[model samples]
Target: MKIDELHQVFLNYPRVCTDTRKIKPGDLFFALKGDNFNGNEYADQALEKGAAYAIIDEEKHTGKQKILVENVLKTLQNLGTFHRRSSKAKVIGLTGSNGKTTTKELINSVLSKKYRTIATSGNLNNHIGVPLTLLSIKEDTEIAIVEMGANHQKEIEFLCSIAEPDFGYITNFGKAHLEGFGGVEGVIKGKSELYDFLIANEKGVFMNADDPIQKEKLKDYINKYGFSTSDTKYYQIRLVEANPFVVISVEDTIMGSQLIGEYNFTNCCAAVIMGKYFNVHLDKIKAGLEEYVPSNNRSQIIEKNGLKIVLDAYNANPTSMYAAIQNFTKIEGGTKVLFLGDMFELGESAHEEHQKIADLAKELDFDNVFLIGQNFYEVKSGFKKMKSFDDLKNHLTKYSLPNSTFLIKGSRGMALERILELI
Candidate 1:
């Protein structure tokens, strides 16, 4: 479809949904095709459900509002680009091996206090998700915080081309998605595409200056910020109080946070630095950071039936796992128990990476450790280990109780959060 045609459709009807499940009355539904499902088959069903109109490729099916398109997914992308030109919102694109989602959430939470903000929901940071998210932006949105994620080379570049971010933030570089990205260097090349995009566009980049790789690649950019030796603007974690709240002071000028640990402090820094760059006031930025809460299971402290639980089991890579373990170690003196599951998709380096995690467990001297999943056998060998989640139950039931802290974490594949039931 032509750009003019898309803009006309967008101006006439502001919202779009590709999934029939989420379609609301009066919303336009784009019947997009997928590997295992043919959305065109469900076009009538979507219209019947509540969709004001259905865009389908089939010629036989026709209605008053139904429009025919050669391809629905491509049309959605084209329509999103047309909508992008109408809004004056500064787009900040964030992508990294770890912490991109959390950073996006934090940045959105912070920016919302000062502007009419639109953010990517959940892990909708891919090809179809990006366009769908952009199309959701209302006409009055002042800032759009888009999280760009990928498992292979140039996936980020493709998304960047669509969003054309005015600014960029890379949380950190680490070993993740080894199957598609090949290895750590491949991850660097893939993620740095955003940095390259920002440089090419003469925009700005925010990164962790402490990372040598980030510092090197972003040095030439005129507009850049980081937390490292080279960074004039840096965030430092001064103290960790633990429990009721974590005290974290950033960059000397800003006071400490209620959120726990230095890692979270750094995450807050990324949001504050980027939000401030967008002309958001310091007080507004502080309010936004303070209002932010943990999404999914990324480090939320909860109490159920009088039992304290630290739920860190959303998704885990080596970098995030290591950070969680370090945070566990600093909890004053408690009967610290760690319920760990397998880390997935590490490719050829799985053994070494698993063993390295085991070494961290031993170094931290966790009071007790339970390893779940077959891949965690190597992790079991590194510490006082249990064979599986059931074995962990047997041990815990037979053992005595203590007022100690417990840390549960693993990749999504292992579903380690299930362990909380037995705790």
Candidate 2:
């Protein structure tokens, strides 16, 4: 069936579910396939669990209340594009290497102060997630914040085609997904695909004037608005301090944020600029920024036992890891400790990247540094290096660092957050 026909069915059953376990009454279940599992096989289960209709690509799964299509994923994406085209909500497409999810959340919080807003839930910023986010927009939604995450070339371009955003933002390109993106240059070109889309379609772009790369790349794009720390033609926000939490001054109005790290200053600024552009009251914008608390292990400060721990174990690449370390170093307090885990996705540069971080830790000379994961173990640093989390756990169980501030960070695979239990 065509996408329009599928959209008609979607109007009746507006709720869409890709997992049989999450199926609810009146949900339009789309069978998505992955390397490890085939969602088509669960079509019968989905219907039994109260799904109104099951969309399947496999002909063998055809049955009552089942719609067989050439490709279920493509149909779902097309339906999302159709819904977005019909939506009255002005969509804001956001992407970047680092801090995409946090920035997206901040933008949503700020925009929702004055408009009925719907944002991409959590880290749902990939191909499947982008379409699902678009499908979540309702008639009452005044603004839709869609976060698009891409690792390689053209992924953002494809998501942009589906989202068809009226405005766009790229957080900042960093050393992330290096394996998939080939290298830093590939990362720049891949992420700049968002800019290419916005420019080609004549959509507005929100940028960081402080970033030389961003400024240089968009030098020719006239429809760009930006925020910067120093004086610029666009918005200017000053960073007050980032001892533990970030405080910024916007138009002489000092706004305090729960977010940590100077790196997050730009994320907060993006929200403030977007809020002002949308005419949200300055006080409301401040309230929105102040109310947001970091969770899901992304720059969260936890107090356990006697130590203050900065848990940034959600994920890490070289760029973010270095920023976190630099921020931790500037905090004046008792002894500073670091639990650095191996950065992932560096590909052939993994050894060199790990060595760079190890060398920095040595240069800073934090009171104590524990490096975990295979990459770090091979760095040949004087700092304590553990082959795995189990090794770190054993060491932590035998020792304790009291009255010290700790920064724990690594890629998601390292599960560095688990160190909290040991501490």
Give the worst 10-residue stretch by lDDT in candidate 2: 225-234
Q: For model 1, state the Cα shift of residue 332 in Å.
A: 3.2
Q: What TM-score, to 2 decimals, does candidate 1 have?
A: 0.91
TM-score of each: 0.91, 0.98
Please give, for residues 75-103, the per-residue lDDT of candidate 2 as tens digits.
88999999999889999999999999999
lDDT of candidate 1 over 162-241, digit per residue (tens): 88898888888887887688998899999999999999988878877778888789766667766543445664434434
Q: Number of the top candidate by lDDT?
A: 2
Candidate 2: C-alpha lDDT = 0.91
lDDT of each: 0.77, 0.91
Which run of 10 residues does model 1 get worst, by summed lDDT? 235-244
Candidate 2 matches the true fold with a TM-score of: 0.98
